[model samples]
Target: MERKRSNRGRWTSVATAVIWIGTTGGASGHEIKVLASQLLTAPGSRDTVYLSWGHIVPVDMPIDAETIKDYRLHTPSGSVNYLSTEGTSLHANVVTVDEEGLYTAEVIRHPSIYTLVIDETGHRHATGSKVEAAKLGGTVDYSARSHQFAKALLISGDAHEGSTKVLGHEFEIVPLDGPESWVAGSDLRVRVLFQGKPAARQDVFARYIGFKPDQAWCFAIPTDNDGIATIRVDRAGTWIIRAQKTLPAALEDRALFDLESYTASVALEVLP
Candidate 1:
């Protein structure tokens, strides 16, 4: 199970909006970012959104081919299916948004991270050999470790007026585009939401992952009472926004000296 309730920061006892991180789990070094041409669309108007998975924090290595197939876009009306993909971009067509809700271009699973662990029940050998468990619960055991994996979920959604919480989990720093979503010479407002609510006073970080005039174009911003942050887009490039937090485990998870840490991010390619 996920870590139990605690008095620690970030990972404190959750209410309706529950955000989580495993006690001893590892995270992916990459993330998926969404791009929409126009966020504020007229009712029944058609628009396009793109999904990019080659967005790794600290570095952006774009892939020359398709990296995902099950990507989608969640709108107020319904979901938009994938139309086509070019290189690392997965294109999805948004038909219309008749209602007054937020439109989100999102993906549930993107960067999958794995690790080896020692646990009860014998595991299979690397060479496809069946190995019997000589011990249980690491009692009088030889070596005990099994492999487990964790996947990261990223969502980049924004509304023209009120930003809705359509898809959000893990430690996500969603960039809320303004009237000029990704246009050059504009300031973008970003929000770091935990679960489905604003994370006030949280430290939000942004950096240019792709090519930029200055390699040191990294900055940190803090969320306000509304859990929203703002950053100015000086030049056009791939902007990466991120945030992280850690907390002590609950009583049950204390056995392994568990420490839960969560990290989340999204990428945006500002047009020149």
Candidate 2:
């Protein structure tokens, strides 16, 4: 009887150890909470965003080695498909703001509980909620600064109206002859292409880069009766522009300018 009781006690201890390991296991299958240091600022800002989390545990009952799950970040701006392998805990790098406002980071598994980061000066608010049109009224002009600028393009778009303001700077929407919507950023260039050919002497709109949430930098320029204009982008990065071709009123169809379609855009990177 004594030997049997000792054997039972040994088995009970082993079972308890297994339960403890399964319930509070490694990083996998555990939920993680994160917090950011200061709201995300402008682009090229230092990636000092800090992340910290709680403990790890199993997903369900009868926890085993396979119960361990991974962690990830879903940012509003760039891709968050990649796992967050940074920091001591499962934390991700803070996102950069091409435009100001609120940004969010959600867990891959738990979508409900997420972190919100705001960049504006006053109260915290959401980003991309307000749809402001592009600034600068119709018939924008781009004159040659020193010499006849080559490789320039024209772009335009409808404004969300007062919805666009960066660092307290207000943008005005303008009407143009062509496409609506343009890319944003300084390192990018804009050009007009027709039938796989380049158009010259076009006037394009202009705006600051990384100032808006959309990261779209472009404006509208009115074309002469000949449908010619000159526009150029001195900066680099993605850009969008709009152009419209109106039909007769009887047609009951106003030509729509898809920003994705017919905009001069380029990804530019400048080196010192």
Q: How close to the true structure is residue 111 of candidate 2, measured as C-alpha lDDT? A: 16
Which ranges of candidate 2 are over 4 A from the true structure?
Answer: 1-31, 48-50, 55-83, 86-95, 108-272
Kindly list the per-residue Cα lDDT of model 2 for residues 1-272, writing each as its tens digit.
75565455434533443443344222111222223333323434433222222221101122121212333333333343333453234343544434322333322121111111223342221211112111212221111001000111111112122211111101111222122222222122333433333344333333223423221223444444433443333334322232322112222211211111122211111111
Error of 2 at 92 (Å): 4.9
Tens-digit lDDT string for candidate 1 (60-151): 45533344434455555555544445655344444444554455455444322222234455422121111322222222211112111111
Give the runs in model 1 whose Cα sits over 4 Å from its true position.
1-71, 80-103, 109-165, 176-181, 211-217
Give the worst 10-residue stretch by lDDT in candidate 1. Answer: 141-150
Task: Give the TM-score (vs. native) of candidate 2.
Answer: 0.21
**RMSD of each candidate relative to the true structure:** 12.5, 29.1
